[model samples]
Target: MALASLAAASLPTAAAAVRSRVSLLRRAMAASPSSSSCAGLAGSPARVGVVQMTSVGDLDANYATCSRLTKEAASAGVKFLCFPEVFSFIGSKDGESIKIAEPLDGPIMQRYRSLAKESSMWLSLGGFQEKGPDDSHQYNTHVLIDDSGEIRSSYRKIHLFDVDVPGNMVYKESRFTTAGDTVVAVDSPFGRLGLTVCYDLRFPELYQCLRFKHQAQVLLVPSAFTKVTGEAHWEILLCARAIETQCYVIAAAQAGKHNEKRESYGDSIIIDPWGTVIARLPDRLSTGFAVADIDLSKVEAVRTKMPISEHRKFDSDWKTS
Candidate 1:
């Protein structure tokens, strides 16, 4: 489908009627805490908080920032929270990163687990450099921690960001990280969540499997996107994924200058099923968060109205199950 056509399809419908109904629903939800999640749908919407950060080599400082952000999100009544890729730490060099890589059961993760229990909230720990089995190549691993602080799912990033730009910057992630081979999804309060990391944003086939095969309702793209590419393609790609898959897309990002050599484009966003940008944040050094109400009804509504999944034609040769 043409991008313009999808944009036009999502324009306001019966504007006055929708405004009035939304106002009433908000009022009702504010009055009852227990019923807030399901105010406008059969199943309760998962209220999500996306945390944006600029993490460097200081593990303790990153933890403090995350601690403050997590506490604030918890107070705001969010059930689940997601942090940017490499939320744990982003070192100045690949050698430094390899030196600091930790196991899933390391002290850093233990601290995160404790924090999750303290806040009584579920957390997507985003991406961290995990020590590979052989201890030579690292894995860009993402972990999903439940409300009770149990590790529910872990996905190693499949796409290594190997890019080059003349007179700009060149990054060959495969030199330091081993690519993963699995398509992972986990069941959560929000819905079934399809997991992918920074460079995975460029590949649409992986997302298709998450939607069609795994029946994922939400997709998480935690990233440390370069400023150049992010400016050009970030929102466009994020919205396209949401529109094509008919799923909620939450992208927490590393924003601002992390070190002397690198900076990230940080327009962190949460997009809905119909490609509507619900919440967003500008690039900044300070830690910040934006919350979005995740209603599966909206996903179903778009799918029912468009029926694109049923209309797909080139399915026989498609891979990535």
Candidate 2:
């Protein structure tokens, strides 16, 4: 089914940039005399930020960009900061990435953890390359760091990118990486968060398991989506997931042309429960970050009105046990 059918009917207009939407929200919040008067809410809004980068093969350049943007988010009072897929390095060729692949406890992970602690914000590293025990294989993984700088959880990209898109857009991630067999979600101060990497976003079942089975309140998609496909379906699919699951969606994207040949569509966005673009960064840049105060109460209010969770219909024909 087309993903747009599952979402609200609001295509973002040119006038509705992230900054303007946020400014309007702040004004509304200020205008309300009491927090209870707005949305009949119970808790304070959580501040979330996303970092979008135009990462290339240079490790130093990528690290510098991450460092600068993450610090900027922290200074702006973001409680949680997230990066894009393969934030460390995206090489010119496939096997070339193996050169930069490090262990889970390597310098790259350590640096990110230290940064999380220093900034006093929860950090989600999009996806990194980790060298497996053998020399022939690696794992595409996302690492979550708590505010205390501890590695809270890690999720490997379960659904590998093994597609042959027309016009030379062929990528067989299984060529160098092994697939993960598990779904992962972690608990955070703001809410429960489901974590997934680039290609995993296409699989709605994975997200269903995260939302329905695991009870995730937020979904994180750290991706380096290709320009060819992202333009056609990125925002629609993200909003669909948010509206259908009643969860906040934060997608940190790798935007702009990377090398002489590779290009990525960078329109990093944070969508609220009502399928609204609360925050977004520009399409091209070395360093850009967006912050939004997500009111968790909206999740409860939406779900209370439409109790899809309790009204689930089981498919007896598709029963497995």
- lDDT (Cα, tens digit) per residue for candidate 2, span 1-321: 001000011223234433443343344333523311122145588888877778899988888888777777777778888889989998997688777788989997888888889889899898899885567678899989988899999988876776665554667788889776567777777788888998777667667767776677889999988876787778988999898888899998998888986888788889988899888864444358877888778888888998999987755447686
Q: Across residues 1-321, which tens digit of lDDT does each residue of candidate 1 receive?
A: 001000001112255644543444344333522311212246777788887888889999999988888888888888888988999888887677788788899888888888899999989987888887666688999999987888889999976776673334878887888877677877777877889998788767778767776677889999998877777678899999999999999998998888998888786779999899888764344468888888888888888999987888763468866
- In model 2, which residue pairs have backbone atoms overlapping below 3 Å? 255-266
Q: How many residue pairs clash in each candidate?
A: 0, 1
Please report, as a residue range, the 10-residue window in candidate 1 with the lowest summed lDDT: 1-10
TM values, all candidates: 0.84, 0.84
The local lDDT score (0 to 100) that residue 168 gets in candidate 1 is 47
In angstroms, the error of model 2 at 83 is 0.5
Q: Find the 10 residues in a row with the least total lDDT in model 2.
A: 1-10
